[model samples]
Target chain A: AQSVTQLDSHVSVSEGTPVLLRCNYSSSYSPSLFWYVQHPNKGLQLLLKYTSAATLVKGINGFEAEFKKSETSFHLTKPSAHMSDAAEYFCVATKGRDDKIIFGKGTRLHILP
Target chain B: SQTIHQWPATLVQPVGSPLSLECTVEGTSNPNLYWYRQAAGRGLQLLFYSVGIGQISSEVPQNLSASRPQDRQFILSSKKLLLSDSGFYLCAWSASRDSPLHFGNGTRLTVT
Candidate 1:
């Protein structure tokens, strides 16, 4: 079975500080990984996706994630945090089986102003 | 420039009432549609997906049923609502299997 684990349920960071949210995935096949952000009652928006092209994937809002194949980890990072960056982040993986995707429990990011 | 739309942004219904949530896609053709329910602070649980009109696949066994009456319209229906059914319902669409999904603003359903 394919699944994603988010290391932190909640992460607090000060404005202008670096932010890191850790995620680990387990898959039997070549996986397609993605990061999504949901703001309050709004729907989820795709951040970035890793389709085995590049190890370092860049996304919107000065956010990026590194795919560590050796460690089976895809951790999201940002050089600086803004108040607008506060949202719920989810790590997702798709194994191309039954056209289904696995979603993480999500990490709530809080930016302290 | 495709967009997905889900109606009834917020709904409050009494128990045992029939529930219907409508979703439609525009600017896309023959897209795959999906319906998902999110519990409080939990990940999304996929309820149903449709590849095309009249083709619906269920991911989880539940009291709800889905129908794709048109190429770009998908509807989720429950004959009798339960309190457990109260959650945020999201509608999403993808161009294909390899494409990322685009979600609409979800409908917050509260079955009181």
Candidate 2:
């Protein structure tokens, strides 16, 4: 079974400050991890993905996440939080050929101006 | 450059009504398709998936059903709508087993 857990349900930060959205995953094998963001009434956009090749992944909108095997974490981070960065973030895990995807509860990020 | 499209961006229906949502993919062949639902303020839940035409696998048991009549077309249906069926439905596809799933714009369905 593969699963993911988001460490926070809500995170608040000031504009231009660094942001961190924590995610941890559980997998029986080498699973692929992804970060997706959704704005109000909009579709989900892929932020990043982690395969066996890369431990550090960068994504759109100045976002990035690091895949750590020792800690079992793939926390999303941003160098600077912009006002348009307010959205819901989801951490997902899936194993190849298994055709299964598991998502975390989600973390709502609030950017304060 | 593969693209997926889901129809009826927003739908409002009454209880017991029949439901049908269509999805189509372009610029790809024999892609893996999936149907997912997101409840209010919740994460996505996988409902169904298909690897090829006329082949479907269900992940959860619910009032909804899925079909893959053509290589690039996937449909989600329900004989009778339920109040609990209200959510954002998303259609997605992947090039192969090792690729990441790309999602469509999604449909917001509301059952009254």
Q: Model 1, stretches more than 4 Å misplaced?
A: none
Say which candidate scores most in DockQ: 2
Instruction: For every candidate, give the share of true A-B contacts it also has.
Output: 0.51, 0.53
Residues B1-112 of candidate 1: C-alpha lDDT, one tens digit per residue: 7989998999999999999999999999999899999999888998998889999999999889999999999999999999999999999998766567899999999999
- Candidate 2 Cα misplacement greater than 4 A, ranges: none
> Which residue pairs overlap in candidate 1's backbone?
none
- lDDT string for model 2 (A1-113, tens) is 67799999999999999999999988766688989998987778899999978899999989999999988899999999999999999998877776467789999999999
Error of 1 at A13 (Å): 0.8
Reference-based TM-score, model 1: 0.97
Q: Residue A107 of candidate 1: its Cα lDDT?
A: 98
Kindly list the per-residue Cα lDDT of model 2 for residues B3-108, writing each as its tens digit: 8899989999999999999999999999999999999978888899999999999999999999999999999999999999999999999877657788889999
Assess chain B of each prediction and give its TM-score.
0.98, 0.97
Instruction: In model 1, state the lDDT of residue A104.
Output: 92
Candidates' TM-scores? 0.97, 0.96
**Model 1, span A13-105: residue lDDT tens:** 999999999999987666888899999989999999898999999999889999998889999999999999999999988756354777899
